[model samples]
Target: MQSFDPKLDRRRFLIAGAAAAVAVPAIAQDGLIDEPAAGTDPDVVHNISSFRARDWRPHFSSLSGGAILVDTGSRALHFWSSDSSTYRLYPTSVPVSEELTRRGRTEVVRKVVGPSWAPTPSMKKRNPEWPDFVPPGPNNPLGTHALYLGWQYYRIHGTHDTRKIGRPSSNGCIGLYNEHIAQLYELVSPGCQVLLI
Candidate 1:
């Protein structure tokens, strides 16, 4: 029998622990641990990878069905179904100002397909290089659709840049990937209740 070496044992233990930590999240991301709902679109399944681990799973919510809930802190959105137990999760971008993400109840005042973008007065002041108007198209910052909020100036819109999801990169609007927004737009309609928290 060989004598025990404390240093070698500690090194092996650390190596094993580090490997386990990395593997757990990887497995979760691959949809192995958190199986998606049956018949979930492949694109939606792919989009879930962008969400943080804590925000990836579905849970019971007290909010009524047919409601949209935005969790700014987690950079995630949940569209609750009529049953309340089911929801579609999507990652979103956060606003630069915390105040812009005020918590309250609101409704979708309007819905537009291929929305035009006109930088607000404050936005123009902050970025002089920004164009006064951007026509609705691939280049438009609003992407494919927009759900205008009753709170004014705020929206849940799509973005041409997919990488912006799950980041703090928007002025005040919640940004979802173009494909994700297209799917969301079909599910939402004018006057739908929206809760920002």
Candidate 2:
């Protein structure tokens, strides 16, 4: 199996452009970094602000590595060990019990860094008072990490709303927890396979 390292080689990562290239700091390492042990540090959870992507999604090979499939229809998220197989299944934080949770298909097109939160016209139509670009803060609706969805004007981003996880809350975007999105930001590169089935 190919090793997946957080501190992966920058040269090994294929990005869309210079902007995306600088979003995450790809560290160099030989073997995959052991995942943070459960209860490693209550005070040391990696914040979403850690590795932000701006505009890169060319490194991920759709046929390789792990694939994360999120289905809003059932309010569920599934992780495939590999494209050719399925065994490892990880559920999301909350039950996708809201209407905002939905399902569709999209490829990993572009990733962002400290991404600007631009409310969609639809979002603005629903919430005329919503701000354009949410400040890059812990409480920002965009949360800490963000992986821009191929969907037009849509994104799968981190959220400060732990209570909203798995619940349909977004106008049309997929919501991820602060840490999970940050971890994903570190692990996957641009173009990493993503299907919102």
Candidate 3:
């Protein structure tokens, strides 16, 4: 895991699927999703070596595509592909979880894509080179895509800083690689169920 970098505060990270509220300037490039992208690791995405076991409704429960569970404390994301492909990539400093439970399980929420990466004033204050908006790319810093967790800005996504793939990095954004984010992109959406066990 990568140590936390103040530049990319997870709290200010963008909320995906919603547009027109805040459009940061950007230099457009080919918005293409390459296969290799799905394979490369992203800085914002955390990883786990093994998974336990669980049972639940499929992620395709109508409007509920299931959920992605994340255990930030565990430094891993469990892809419960069975019950909505749960993802468990925990953020470092998540406040006391206020979420309720069902059948002794955490409630799953919607999945997201290309989650926005809105920088903090401190980020700009520290790094003047930081741009208001960074388009999606290997250097964009927000990685490629983010899996927004529940209501908070917390998420799991690709990273601008991937050197810390297996280490803790960012204010809270889980880091993977550009290619990895793209790969996850092909399988998930904003409504997929997730459990942060």
Candidate 4:
């Protein structure tokens, strides 16, 4: 057998390794690699209010009335109530949690009247002053009613602080004014599709 050239062999090996390193991510980006699901971190506080959705009009005609669509960027939640392109637009607020705010398709998992608030572990960790639980009442963070999302720890709920509506101030949950949430609670039911974008 011919003598092996160490330098040439090493160079070839390095080039092949570099090519694979580049190709691996490309394959993964194309959905070749199985990745783990991402987790959400709860926020510490929710006291904020400023912007609001002022105009309400038929913006899109594609979605069917009765679907709930949330625009995170604008902090607006729309409930299509009729087939005639008209929809109820409510100013809403989302949590500072970016991952939880990511675009995804999920349905209303549960509906509750006068729901209580239970601080998530992460939330409590962030805010040591937060109580372990909050009872349902005028001061309840859940407000009058709550529409829980399929994802854990996320919901479209009413807030005692109506000012927070239209502000970015939650731990990943969506907040609507008490009256607005009451109307939404009546209009929606379990299994209603919720699109968060």
Candidate 5:
């Protein structure tokens, strides 16, 4: 008959627990684990892999008027010039929570350099301490340039906080590094078609 050894059972349990503890954080770091971003709602689970290059053809029928595809899941923005002569992929910061996320077709209705910023009603309500308006400058949330989308309060803009890129950190807009956005601003125009997926 086999003997029950408490010490052996305890040792086995400890080793298994330790292995799981180590593995879980690594998986989360790689974005393979389903978890909410820090300071976000627990219900907002983000399960996204690292950025992978994508073909614009699958997302848009044509690059007419230029095309911008923001893959929220991958936190990457893909841009194609009208003539297909220019293709650029940029890391971006997406909505912090799913509720704030907006998907589907839109277009750049306006292009602004050194754009001013105002907190949306919801944003102001959520963050009462935020300023009512911020003029274009170093502290501006819109960074050096802005592409105002057809959807109100949503923009493909640059951010002063570079750490927000490639993470779920924005309220709803897609944010890029100031330098990258500046480059994109030159490539795109007011009529550029945008798809957030």
Candidate 6:
């Protein structure tokens, strides 16, 4: 089995994009690094703000069947293996506004590779110009993999748009890098526990 290390992998990911990186100082007590208020230019969104490793105990009773804790404020996801061995931390894109965010526990109800996409009813109502459906491909918003949550229209999925990572960009779902989500897809199973906070 391939091992995962949050520190080492995070360093590698940062080094690969060092040219475009900005200084990241620690932020407020809430654990979320403050960013420019909502509605700022998407291009200006920071690739990563606060990336921190967390103990799964506070969020989960145990790691049986594995556990995933998504810190929406920090724009990061933490995963722990069922045996409490492997752990991974990945920067993620969160819901754009408080109204779009959902907190509490859910389980991965399904896992799909090369998943298709369709905007939710709320999404369509807000933006009627979007297509009714999009086949699995480069243009699909769900990217290469998706972990369908117990909640309707919610997923922990990947995005082709790298700029969305570490920013509040998704309509409601949590977004990860295509590569990260692909790796996560391999490690997680359908009944894996998930918490969004």
Winning model by TM-score: 6
Best by lDDT: 5
Candidate 6 TM-score, C-alpha based: 0.76
- Expressed as tens digits, the lDDT of each residue in 1-197 for candidate 4 is 98899999999999999999989866655653223235522211121232232222333334443568787877888676545354577889887768546567787889999999889887889899988888899978989999999888889999998778777888888999999999999888686767887
TM-score quality measure for candidate 3? 0.47
RMSD per prediction, one decimal? 9.0, 17.6, 19.1, 16.8, 9.6, 14.1
lDDT, candidate 2, equals 0.57
Model 4, residue 116: C-alpha shift (Å): 0.7
lDDT comparing candidate 4 with the true structure? 0.75
Deviation in Å, model 2, residue 164 alpha carbon: 0.7
Tell me the lDDT of candidate 6.
0.89
The alpha-carbon lDDT assigned to residue 73 of candidate 5 equals 83
For residue 70, model 1's alpha carbon misses the true position, in angstroms, by 0.5
lDDT of 6 by residue, 1-197 (tens): 97999999999988877744433333333445345458864323243344655667767888999999998988889899999989998999999999999999999999999999999999999999999999999999999999999999999999999999989999999999999999999999989999998
lDDT per residue for candidate 5 within 1-197, as digits (tens), equals 99999999999999999999999877777865455558965533444555555667778898899999998988889899999988888899999999999999999999999999999999999999999999999999999999999999999999999999989999999999999999999999888999999
Candidates 5 and 6 compared: the better one by TM-score is 6
Candidate 1 clashes between residue pairs 3 or more apart in a chain or in different chains: none
What candidate 4 gets wrong by more than 4 Å, as runs, is: 1-65, 82-86, 97-100
Instruction: Compare candidates 4 and 6 on lDDT and give the better one.
Output: 6
- Candidate rank order under lDDT: 5, 6, 1, 4, 2, 3
User: Tens digits of per-residue lDDT for model 3 on 1-197?
Assistant: 98786656543454432343444222112222222236644322321332222223332243255445444555444444434434433222221223321111233244445555667675577678877876655556666676665545456577756565655555545556667666665666655555544
TM-score of 5: 0.74
lDDT of each: 0.78, 0.57, 0.48, 0.75, 0.90, 0.89
